[model samples]
Target: PSDFSGFTVDGFKDEFEKLVETDSKSIVLDLSKTEFIDSSGIGAIVFLYKRIEKKNHKLMLLNVTGQPYKLMTLLRVDKTIPFVDSI
Candidate 1:
């Protein structure tokens, strides 16, 4: 969604959960369109990461830029979760 803030995090969480059922070895969350993200959004990403990790699946953040990128970098989350510029 456009706004990956607290308002959209619940939906993101629900949708992300469904992705776990897919057979794909890697799950990528494209943040190119996300203009805004709050703590709730970050929490959702962390939660998703843990879920994917437990399943031995990989989670990648794609096109993360602007404030979201800065925040994740600042928190050192980017160190744990891989960020990809392309597929």
Candidate 2:
């Protein structure tokens, strides 16, 4: 688990990438704490998911409520990635 609050684009990307490096079966993105997200932020998440998938790991999005969820749905990113029920 990771919290991306107050993190910049590259910082979140870097941290996400680092988390993927660990030999874990699943990575749950806690988007609940994230108050803002730009295009780059979305890109970072997609990148992480792709990389994790390549390694046969799973990625799940959590607590994706409010504006972030709306933005993702509007961008059609929600269709590309699945969301979990609870955070």
Candidate 3:
């Protein structure tokens, strides 16, 4: 979604749950189109990251830019969550 805020966080969480059930080794969230994000969104991402980490997997944020990128950087989320320009 373009807006990864509270309004969309629930959906993200639901998706995360589905991802948890999968056997995939790596998970990448493509945020190229997401222009806005709030604390709830950030929190969800962090939670997803930790969960994936616990599974000894990986969670990568892709194409993070604009305001969302700034907010993530400000919160130092970029340090904890890997951000990639491509796959």
Candidate 4:
């Protein structure tokens, strides 16, 4: 997903909710190609992370770099959700 901002967060939330409802054990968000992320996007991801945890599931961010990485670090999201360079 690219430009993970307010305009795109709702759709992402809905789709992610579906996956959670279907008992997804883990979710890997691939941010390699994502160029940007706003506060709304961060909130959405955090919300999803909490939801997954409620079901004993995990959420991982993959290939985060540039703006997204910096934002995540600034927000201390990396402290909560684990991230990796690849799947």
Candidate 5:
């Protein structure tokens, strides 16, 4: 997923919800190409995280960087969610 801003959050949310309906054991959001993220994007991610947790599935974020990384860190989303620089 790249550029997780307001414009992209809704699409991401819809796709994520559909994925969550499957039997996948885990979900790893690949943010390697993402350069920015806004409050709406953060909200969407949080919503997915909660839904995943309710389904007893694991959720992780990979390759976070730039403004997105800083904002996530500052908001303590990194602390609450699993995050890694790479796989």
Candidate 6:
């Protein structure tokens, strides 16, 4: 849940799936240290969002910036999730 420096689609997909099962109503993914993202990463993020919403929970993102941020913006994910700058 840190840098995701060597992120793979399967790894993120599995981890995010587990996160949505938590009792907490919200989850935050810290992406401040992440510098880039691929299509697989984007899909994993969207999967997290939908999973949390389906369970009436919130999926939050913090400290997400740089190229990853730009890609999210382009994909309109920023509009769907609340993100803070380096929180």
Q: Comparing candidate 5 with candidate 6, which one achieves the higher lDDT?
A: 5
- Write model 3 residue lDDT over 15-69, tens digit each, in one string: 8898877789999999999999999999998988888888898899999999999
Candidate lDDT values, in order: 0.87, 0.77, 0.91, 0.89, 0.86, 0.78
Across 1-87, the per-residue lDDT of candidate 6 in tens digits comes to: 333433556666667768988898878888876777877777778878898899999988887788888888988898999897644
Candidate 2 per-residue lDDT over residues 1-87, each given as its tens digit = 233333567565667768889899888887877666767778888888899999998888888877678788899887868888684
> Which structure is stronger by TM-score: 1 or 2?
1
Those runs of model 4 whose alpha carbons end farther than 4 Å from true positions after fitting are none
Ranking by TM-score: 3, 1, 4, 5, 6, 2
Q: Give the per-residue lDDT of model 5 (tens digit) for 8-81.
A: 78776668878679788888889889988999988988888899899999889998889998999999999888
Which parts of model 3 are misplaced by more than 4 Å?
none
Which portions of model 1 show Cα errors greater than 4 Å? none
User: Candidate 6: where are CA atoms >4 Å away?
Assistant: 1-7
Residue pairs of candidate 4 with colliding backbone atoms: none
In model 3, residue pairs whose N, Cα or C atoms come closer than 3 Å (at least 3 residues apart or on different chains), thus clashing, are none
TM-score per candidate, chains pooled: 0.93, 0.81, 0.95, 0.92, 0.91, 0.84
In model 4, which range of ten residues has the least summed lDDT?
A: 17-26
Per-residue error for 20 in candidate 4, Å, reads 1.4
Model 1 TM: 0.93
Identify the runs in model 2 with alpha carbons over 4 angstroms from their true place: 1-7
Question: Which has the higher TM-score value, candidate number 1 or candidate number 4?
Answer: 1
What TM value does model 2 have? 0.81
